[model samples]
Target: MKIQEIREIIKLMDQSTLDEFVFEAEGTKLKLKKHNGETRPTVHTSAQPQEQPAAVVTPKTDAPKVEAAPAEPIEKQESTSSEASSSYKTITSPMVGTFYSSSSPEADSYVKVGDRVNADTIVCIVEAMKLFNEIEAEIEGEIAEIHVKDGQLVEYGQPLFSIK
Candidate 1:
């Protein structure tokens, strides 16, 4: 997507009541959010084949964070997956929100390293706008790694777990 298009998206999101907006097409993922009444955007791209900026911004900084590192999962997760860890697939967040490893604080984590999971298994939860969204394994495998911690903020497309 062009910067103009992204700017337009920010404008639209700023005007709407929705606190967040996500757009993904081809190999690029764009996330925008309204926080404390401020409009912030995140950009995530992978080998797009199209010319685009590797705009990395942080919520605290004036950058997009590349999934805005809301995943900061964007930084470590990227390097974590790119180098020396190509054998496993990852479970990425479908939306931006707070990641919870269990149903509640007192509950046991949904899955841990070495745990086997089927495609439909609920491995975690992402809370967004007071909604608790169950994050499924989506792929059958044993949990190889947990990328994000419980109660941590995660951006769209940020990897939450690595499965082998």
Candidate 2:
């Protein structure tokens, strides 16, 4: 199928609130499905050439979760996933608020490139209302990448680590 025709069909779907489109033309059949604000394309072509374009649009569906890391590493971790070994310290929030790695816009971050931290170390700050509440590490480990940035709103259980 030509690229221009696919674009036009997608445009039509967005404008008309249509969720799925299927078309058959010149022994070639094409099906376009849109879900979770994303579009997926499927095409089927017959051996003999005939043009009979047809389009069908399906209903919207829920969005998939963020893609996970490869299965091999996760599988390795799964054997140890249930361990009582609290070797890594998780710096978590005390209250629901926005998380900030830096105190101010231009200041150095509370935790940086490779800082080691313990239970008492203030890793970052979670701002609730006008008050800034410092977040402390609950375990001991070298600093991994800070997941959220300064002034970024964080949900109660949002992850912020990749401890080794």
Candidate 3:
């Protein structure tokens, strides 16, 4: 793909909740990732031909750089779940894909906090390979929390919702 096309994809990813994106066509592959809330995304490209070297593209314009604060040692906090909180069960994503809280942008979410659900309840939709798959809440209880936002990319076994 052309650098301009890759730049456009980066722009779209920045607007969405996606942190990383991988695209492969023919024998070329492109991967982009954003880190530490940086405005510019890092790009990596690879070609199938073993002798062909990958290219790294950097923006031409000079941007102001802000120095990051010194890292501080993180202190671990003890888990303090009460009996009520301990009873909550998490509904995890069954596949790696984008999570949609509703069927469409104009539609209401399938489930929300304080909503009761059962095994047959369609909690959300996970889109993979352009196919939208309805995700069912296998546990019976009230939704304690919605762990993921709409259009967020989720991995297999990632917590999507909590029930109690």
Candidate 4:
């Protein structure tokens, strides 16, 4: 597989909620694991050419490898809950972007656990492209939990903050 193909697959994983991926061909095998950090940043290295590059072709694969894509973090513990009143509300993202807890790197988070919030209160920032969009709470409640972390890539309608 070409390097570009590998990068494309990685980008797809980051864009979606999917986590791990594996592919195996006759003798070539590929396994990708997403780390705990936010979306990967563009990395530049020395000894790289700065001129226009030619298009490369990738060969098709016929791998039958078993693949596992854990949606959530493997380190997160799961516990059963006696159904509450079912009165809790979920605040979802309005767009697909990088989720941020603060306006800048040096600023405090917009909202945190146990923080009292109401409608129209900015809860976080979802950066799409170069613009940082402020996400607001649509319901009144205390922040029960935050689903995504700072600099994390969030999908449209993804759960951001849970209210109760």
Candidate 5:
């Protein structure tokens, strides 16, 4: 019913496996829907804050149809991902957010390629809903690759690093 409550719900939804959420309380209806596997950057605008209102959904029957990716490319992607998983352990993002390599812009990166890390090592920060969460490398190994760059928007369960 409040803006903060709505934001919290959105954050939880982003971190979860659910793609759609709906709630009706006190004559007010709220619905949250997101297209999974389609990662898009969120653009924020500077404007005066306004009163909150229930979400409105409109059906778009005339929307253009999108063709799925070809089978060969999908197969190739699957093969590569499987190979990587087989050879290396991965550090994955637990929630969708903007990835930061350091605590701040002026600070050094938490870790780099060829750097060895333990299970408790903090590798990066993932900011979601104005909350910066420290991401840890859960496996002890050498950093084989960094999958994302600073300020990049990452999705839940997306690989952030490859460790050998």
Candidate 6:
């Protein structure tokens, strides 16, 4: 019924082995199905009567590939400068959204390279459906790299930061 409840259902589905889930409450119906192994699940919701088509809310998990842009150069530079032997864990986006480094444009970024973070640390915000969700590090480590640029439209599960 609420966004939090829906999010919890998604989280549970992701962690479990089930590939599909359907629920009907009151007059509303919800159906969630995961596609490919690496893809985010799709959600379909509809009210009774079935006159109108069911509303499908699919996250923008993939974008059309385009030619190299100016931003690629910076990413290349960062990758090249990093040590080849460094071992790190990447923090990926849990949902598709526009990635923001700070709560506001004037505020300092939540984390940067060389900054240590724990599971509770809010490293960034992902704005979806006009709601800004704070994304946590979920692991204990020092940030080693940032893979996405600020204000970039990111895909679900896309790497955001690497930690060591």
Best by lDDT: 1
Best prediction by TM-score? 1
* TM-score of candidate 3 to 2 decimals: 0.50
lDDT of 4 by residue, 21-81 (tens): 5544323445555568333423323354323222222212344434333223223222133
Screening candidate 5 with a backbone cut-off below 3 angstroms (N, C-alpha, C), the clashing residue pairs are: none
* Candidate 1 local lDDT, 18-105, one digit each (tens): 6666665557888787889988899888775433323333344455434422222244456354433777888888777999999988
Worst 10 residues of 4 by lDDT: 52-61
Cα-based TM-score, every candidate: 0.56, 0.43, 0.50, 0.50, 0.53, 0.55
**Candidate-wise lDDT, in order:** 0.74, 0.60, 0.69, 0.65, 0.69, 0.70
Clashing residue pairs, backbone N/CA/C < 3 A, model 4: none
Candidate 6, run of 10 with poorest lDDT: 68-77
> lDDT at 26 for candidate 5?
41
Q: How well does model 2 score by local distance difference test?
A: 0.60
- Once all C-alphas are superposed, what RMSD does model 4 give against the true structure? 15.5
Error of 1 at 57 (Å): 20
lDDT by residue for model 2 over 1-164, one digit each (tens)? 55644664565566654466666656777777777766677778789965434444454545432332221211112113343245643444444588888778788877784788777877787775566767677677777555666777875446554343
Which portions of model 6 miss their true places by more than 4 Å?
1-81, 84-86
Residue 22's lDDT within candidate 6 is: 59
Comparing 3 and 5 on TM-score, the stronger one: 5
